[model samples]
Target: MTTEVIKKPPTWFWVVSVIALLWNLMGVGSYLMDAYVSIEQLEAMSQEMRELYEGRPAWVTACFAVAVFGGTLASIALLLRKKWARPVFIISLIAAIAQFTHWLFMTNSVEVYGTGVYIMPILVIAFGVYLVLFAKKGIANGWLK
Candidate 1:
């Protein structure tokens, strides 16, 4: 009888996986807070931030939900060695791009928050793109089933 021994990912894979999970969890927390904060809490923000938050359209909020939720689920799928991670990560990247587009072009966020606000969005988009490619590579290399 032949026993097939499955291959395990390298050390960096586990490290990256855990870090990705933690990172996406933070995004989920931010999304939850943004979506469900109390009226009083929302009122406590600086006028610029409050205005920005209040001005967000339903579609923008929905994009935010998709970005965070998709990223979070993709992380889980990656850890579980599921092939579905690729598509989920791609979804996350697209949602993230949409969110960033809204913030960068559709809103006054940059004018209100100064150029520093752009940095995070850029980072998020870059990370989103990286994760999509990462998941694709994982699948192609047999790190993900």
Candidate 2:
């Protein structure tokens, strides 16, 4: 009998994994800050975030944090080729869409910050594509089995 050892994932996979790690770490830190920070600090952070988002609601900000947490876990699982990562990634994509929708429809303002404000839509689209591609890759690599 012969045994075969599979090769490692592609370099891009590792690169994505690193990005995911950063996302997850940031997500966790935000939650911690939201919980432990002083009211003034929270307000300051919220103000900064609002400026970036053009007056998006506070609930949207919280949901965005949840999505980041999901994405971070999914990304880590992807590194280990865990089966649940695909579903988590899908959930993250849906959450991202929901987050974007909050910005597009529910948000009270239309005054985009600057020329680069269009990047928000582009980021959502990129996240959607990333979710699809990584989900397929996860399945192909036996991560979803």
Q: Identify the candidate with maximal lDDT.
A: 1
lDDT of each: 0.86, 0.67
- The per-candidate count of clashes, in order, stands at 0, 0
Measured against the true structure, the TM-scores of the candidates, in listed sequence, are: 0.91, 0.65
Clash pairs (backbone) in predicted model 1: none
lDDT of model 1 at position 138: 82
By TM-score, the best candidate is: 1
lDDT of candidate 2 vs native?
Answer: 0.67
Which residue segments of model 2 deviate by more than 4 Å? 1-7, 27-62, 112-116, 143-145
Candidate 2 C-alpha RMSD relative to the actual structure? 4.9
Worst 10 residues of 1 by lDDT: 2-11
lDDT of 1 by residue, 23-136 (tens): 899999999988998989988899988989888888888889998999999999988977798899888888888888999998888888889988888888888888888888
